[model samples]
Target: MSLIELHTRSLELAAELIDTVQPEQLVLPTPCADWSLRRLMEHVVGQHRGFAAAARGAGPDRALWRDAPVGADPGGAFRGSAAELTAAFTAAAGTPGRSRLWLPEIRDGGPFPLDLAVGFHLLDTLVHAWDVAAALGPSSAAGIAAAVEAEPPLAGALLAVAEVVPAAPADRGPGRAFAPGRAPATAAGSFGRALALLGRDPDWAPPAR
Candidate 1:
């Protein structure tokens, strides 16, 4: 319910998703058409670090997160990014209500309320968990639920922002229509399926693959 709880839960789900990735599977295609597993992971870690940076008062330029930046060890790089995000968020949680975050590209303008920092990350973590879980098969539902339960605020935010701005991860491709307060006609196959209905799909499966 709180931002800190949401951040922690998102981190936990993300870790679970990361654990599902085999070394060989890292190169495998994911639901997100343009991103392989590795790329999707990179994007996740990058967004975390970027958001943490903003919460720490650093803007996009100084943000530690980068898009597919070369690393000495790609795997280690991913882990490091996750770790960095965890630390940043942990510190932000300590401050509570006092910390600030800004993302001109995502939000309309100006920094978001210091309070909404965790809520923003919460939505990202939950949706991405579904993305990774769908690619890995049915084993990730628990993690998905964790993300969903951790961020009730995110659901409200999603309803508010669904049509206003683009959904997260940027790699999810085109936006789909979603009618607030209405469920889709078909049953959701997975957590990612539910996310797709909401106009967010970080792990959209590529048809060709």
Candidate 2:
């Protein structure tokens, strides 16, 4: 599948997980330490908008990257952002040189290629969808399935652009996007292996209330 297709699938999976979030679960802790579900949603929305702006040739403006406000209607807010992101990506497809993306923190350097930017975001969406599922606990069967379904396509897309993605450094520091988590056992399926590669424990569940 194309990067755009993978991104679309990832967004759909993310939306599925977001839709399952109970109001009370907003404050729950996720695999991403220090970020509650609510905060994580905000971050997701922010990233969607930021990437949309980048695809539009408007550099990754810091203002566009600002965390979205997770109001009482978090799901609605996220859906809106996701829709905008999809539209922007669709419009930018096949027009690589038309715009430049500003990604200062890129492992290789600044100013990322259009395809690389899109692929990186696709990878992030897939992993974060799983993060949401893990936070929601085992009862979210539908969410879990959606996340699992997204893994292969997104991971394949990432591999297509792996050269741009920075390897996880030895130090699992706060700023790092992924830590070097323990490798998944061979028995772990594609989804589980993808999560493990992204530094997430596939079996992670929320603490009992």
lDDT of 1 by residue, 1-209 (tens): 65565456556656755665676666766655556767777777777768767767675463455665523344455456667766776776577663666665464535676556565566666666666676666446445654554555544453333333344454233442222222433644334344654554433444663
| Model 2 spans > 4 angstroms off | 94-96, 105-109, 139-155, 158-164, 168-171, 207-209
Report lDDT (CA) for all predictions.
0.57, 0.71
Model 2, 51-110: lDDT tens digits are 888777776457877788877667788889989988887787757574457754344334
**What TM-score would every model get versus the actual structure?**
0.67, 0.84
- True lDDT of residue 132, candidate 1: 68
* lDDT for model 2: 0.71
The number of clashing residue pairs in each candidate reads 5, 0
RMSD of each: 5.5, 2.9
